[model samples]
Target: MNLVNMQRKHSSYLLAFFTSVALMSVGTARDLRDVTEPKIPPSCTTLKASGGDDTETIQKALDSCTKGKAVALSPGVFHSGPLNIPSGVGLVVDTGVTLKAITDPALYDLGAKTCGTVDDVGVGCKAFITMLRVTGSGLYGKGTIDGQGNVTLIGQKKSWWDLSEEALVAGTFQNVPRLIQINNSADITMYQLTLIDSPFYFVTSIETNGFTAWGLTIIAPASARNTDGIDPIGSQNVTIAHCNIRTGDDSVAIKAMTAPSRHISVLNSHFGHGNGMSIGSEVNYGASDVLVSGLTLNGSLKGAHIKSNTYRGGHVVNITYNNVCIVDVKNPIYLEMDYVHLHGNRTPEFRNIAFNNIRVLSTGIFILQGLSDSNPVVVSFNDVHITKGSRWSRHFANVTGTWEEDASGHCGYAGNE
Candidate 1:
């Protein structure tokens, strides 16, 4: 349908559904980017990279670092294995330094002979940087953390990305390490960090509260598999702002795997060559109360997506996207319920999603699919302008509100930081 000032025919039904309800009140609004950036703490200790393995030196500094202080890595190339960050401490990679992860699978094996191999259960490798059960801990720097996904393994001919492709063909999973893993931790921060070429997901947090990712630059090749930028899983009160992410998978994926993920905000971010902002294929618990504002997607595979199948499905509500711009994106607005054709008993719900002041500069396929006719996706639009030749494929959706083809306004889109 030509989305020109379109109004829902069943407006009365929606009005009755929300007559006494406030949609924005569905989840808490604890945006971490609402405050100013904190000053970098003074360094408790600084260590120059030895010409050999620096994992022991770095780990020792972090383990002995004082609370409310950071351990600084001097400006040099440092090769290391897995490193842990203690609670109430920080790690800093100073400018002109590149901390590269060693490609030895044995160093990352979790006592399961699954690292550097393919299997059905792929969670077998530990992250390069682990923050477990920590509070007030962070990674701050202007330098880079290079996972070296393209580098060949110590004893294998294939690199990390090559193994990922092989696993896809073999119908299994590649046991590769993630760059950063934050688990069971609270009040964590990642500031001004440049992450590149992760073997798996770049940064992931699970069951943690009060998380923030600000001024992050993440990049990966388009062919790299499973390289998600930042994923907040089963976490609440989170914010990701001023990020420029280009990855193989979702730039920012909000998931509810272990618990309900709620009260999150993603503001003023730019995406390129990735599956843009997304809300899970693992939302089995629920995900609610998310606000994404002042965003841009350029040359992306998908933009503003929500994908979930019956096996990993649950309630997704009270999401808002405001002041967004898209250019040369393929699937502009994709919301699917039968993702990957996974089938089960859990029903998926998408409700009260709002898009305001959006502009798409290129024509692309737009999809909004729900599970069934009885469980249609509920969404609204206001001042959303797309290119004239765009095509829409909608199924089992109650698309309401207004849209236009006059894409003249800029939507206040500033590219990236």
Candidate 2:
């Protein structure tokens, strides 16, 4: 305790470690834009819309509805088949209703019939609003749930987006049927619903654990085929907010194949013409704390995407994209790791990615590939703005900061389908 009282006790321990790192960065920015807009419980049974197969009357009012109530559905057309949704109940759909989804591949086969066919073991159907192993379920509404996928499958003639483009010209896999399938669920939700034309993947959620999709709206067609908008596989503490998502594939895919998808959050979304906020081509069991905020991507074909390969590889770390904008996108910032080249060894790790205040108002193509040269792909950029003839490419990525071409703003939502 000599030298000036030991430098005043090391300046009070660096002022209490910078005040505990500014309170843990404001609690991780409120856990990445805290979302929560779900409250619609209280109805335990409403039904009304018997213009045909209401799938055993909405599966007997969601199997006798009870736990935390909700069965509504009133208003109009509802042709269901393949329902489920039990534990903790919920399933609104009011305001000029529409439910639909009865393309009848034997009502979503899953019984060795290989569903709408296109084989190679595509999991044979089943999913027109299922919520297996449920807990605190949900699906509130303001209407639609279509999945008509351009209707025409009763006996099959194609249409489920033409058998998903004939299973991509017979390379196999297409058992279709998926419009809200929430497996092994827990605290799931999907408020302000709309979800349409999904012959497959439009709100998936496997191994879920506290999922949430607020102000939803999804509408497929950009040549719909695997119309995904809001997938959250191997989920955990997920939250997709203010959704609008016009899809045809990946409007918001954040998969982690069997487990391990960490605290995710996508806020203030908009994305039109899908394939925009993606993260992986399966992601075999690895995906870390992701956070995308205030997105906008219009006419998207890919913007802020992160697709993997090496046969559904793993490990995508602390991803973040803030205040994005990207208009008329066509690969705005695609981070690929040999996406379709497949081949596996399980090694596909993208590192601490970050891009704040992005802008990119046109002139697309900025693919940043990696998975070689000693495995690079660690990114970072701060006020990234891109417009002037934007078209940059990278191979063994490891980029960091700086990206301005002076992007002129304007992406206040105006994305159609």
Candidate 3:
């Protein structure tokens, strides 16, 4: 070959080698970019707050958030009244940011706007954060939400907990607002947040779908009355996972107050010093396709508790329990049909319940009860073993089901049995 032709071929080979190397480097850079990109949307807010009753500014920020951008609470204390969260908005509460709820009752319950049956108890609608019919929204940050539940309202020396306890004596729940209340929302995500000391439930969701709560730390004193951690009322396809909850009431209570709650899951959580992982205090409708798995509970009152009565008209079906470990709990598995003020004719039914792979070290276990007219039927216990030091017995009234060994235990009877 000629020298010029050979030189041209050599230049071509060098260019090809360099081009291949550049292509490989470009591919590696693309992979690194993909790895660094966030799975969730980023919080890019231009709004910054200075101080003192930043409700209007924060609400304006939230209102201005778009699909790609988010509203961020900068690292400081922000006092706010009721704030509404709309659809397609993202809120990021940064670390060291404390959102404090104002204690004035007038801003929330003004003009006689009431929550569910609040008029019967002379209370009105109120909350710290309200999300109604929101979709595709995300709230993820490491911050604190102070409900200020212990503060006394105007002209009332009693705290909210004391007021709630007194109201319970008269069978009324009034004059208290939840920390976060969302209704009919979908695709909502809340993570890595610390919600503390709410006068009512930490988060109350009704008629929501595709909601997820994860990596949440919910805490209140044991004397904080009726302070549930996460309540999903009539919500569908909701998931509560990886939460550390220590509250006064149920750590996670799935209720059926508005509609039927279906496909609810509580997984991989730690519950302490609370009512452990309950189904309902009010199952007025239906709750089905529920699954509770991989829960480690300590110092809680009850585990796998289902409370209803003859008056609450509905059924709990297709509930499954797996891999729950309980220690120092009062009653590990309690299913009762004896809620108070049950005067209605329609009886609640608990059917098709299955318990498997539960290990309990508790004071007692198995309160397996049902109503006389509508007995709890088709409950099967598989591989459930309990070691109770005090009151190691099962209190069975109208519960009729089957159990497999090593389930040799004593069962006490009620008067009808």
Candidate 4:
């Protein structure tokens, strides 16, 4: 029992401690892997190959699904009027399946309903696929949703574009229906789908929460009217990621008319030929704590724009745009409180908007004009470089904020950049 015995005992103790620690680590890893639910991929149920007025047929398929079921569409065209998607169901469109919307206005139109006004956009009765109070559901696939936006309606020589323009000019548009509508729902996911040529907004959500949309291709003609891509209204804890959008209107527009939309994040997406990511052209209620990151906006009309008329305006605060690259965009970073929709008195409250690490190429008239009564509070920027535009071409009025200078010497504030 001398020094050699004591050293041997100490070595044995160290070995025991190391072995226990390694075993504990392996056990923790196993527990982490076990916490995730066993994904069953849902039960697969295919829709029937009906030829005409597939609304009732498709409704039957959707209604026949048990909770958390997968209803798939086969490889062909299924013409449908208006349809309903049940809750706790996942819709899968196969590689060649196309759910074509019937343009026979009478088929889709239930009755004369009010269109998108101050706080009433997604509340109407006529949508291609409507899901109300549907929870824990998903509509995803590698297929297409053909809205036939270019078709000429009955008794009209021109296509939907010309008709839509006429409606916009006349200030009363009730001619088209939206592609997909999800209202007052939660825990929904939409992914990897081609939503094209809608009569109105391609995909819209209202009063919903915990929504996630990704890998979507939303495209329409530039001449097409009001075809917005991923419109999220009054939804919270939402994440839209890796979506490509080329539509006639806003690619990712955040609207809050009836309820406030908060804690929303849009990550790693591309937008073009549209009104870029926007907030509150119709923020009638309020919005807060929204984040957009890793966006590539190419050849679009506006990038990170916020447009609202005085009458249909409310608070939009604590927004952040980070690591964005805007290429060949016109009128990048525009904020107009007085959008030409017949002005009113109540000003919108905007505050704490930050753009970090933004790179712009080829833009015209970077304007941020907030109303005098409701000056936006502290719109700051960091590492924003506009390489292809002149500083004099940029316009600013009444926006009281602070921003770091881009390489082109364009600052966000009136003082030295």
Alpha-carbon RMSD of each model: 2.6, 18.3, 19.0, 14.6
Mark the regions of model 1 whose C-alpha exceeds 4 Å error after superposition. Answer: 1-34, 409-417
TM-score winner between candidates 1 and 2: 1
Best by lDDT: 1
Clashes by residue pair, model 3: none
**Backbone clashes in model 2, listed as residue pairs:** none
Worst 10 residues of 2 by lDDT: 1-10
Give the C-alpha lDDT of model 4: 0.71
TM-score of each: 0.94, 0.34, 0.81, 0.81
Tens-digit lDDT track for model 3 on 244-281? 99999999998998798888777778888989888876
What's the distance in Å from true for residue 351, model 1? 0.2
Q: Report the Cα lDDT for residue 73, model 4.
A: 84
Query: Could you arrange the candidates by TM-score from highest to lowest?
Result: 1, 3, 4, 2
**Per-residue lDDT for 1-417 in model 4, tens only?**
422233244444554553344334322211111111112236557776678777777778788888888788888898887877788887777589998887766666555533222122333337888888989888878899888878776555655566577677766654567899899998788878898899789988899987778788999987787899988998777777788899998998899988987778777788879888999777888877777877888888888897776887888777777778776677778877777764676567766676667777554557666666436433554456665433322223322222333444332211112
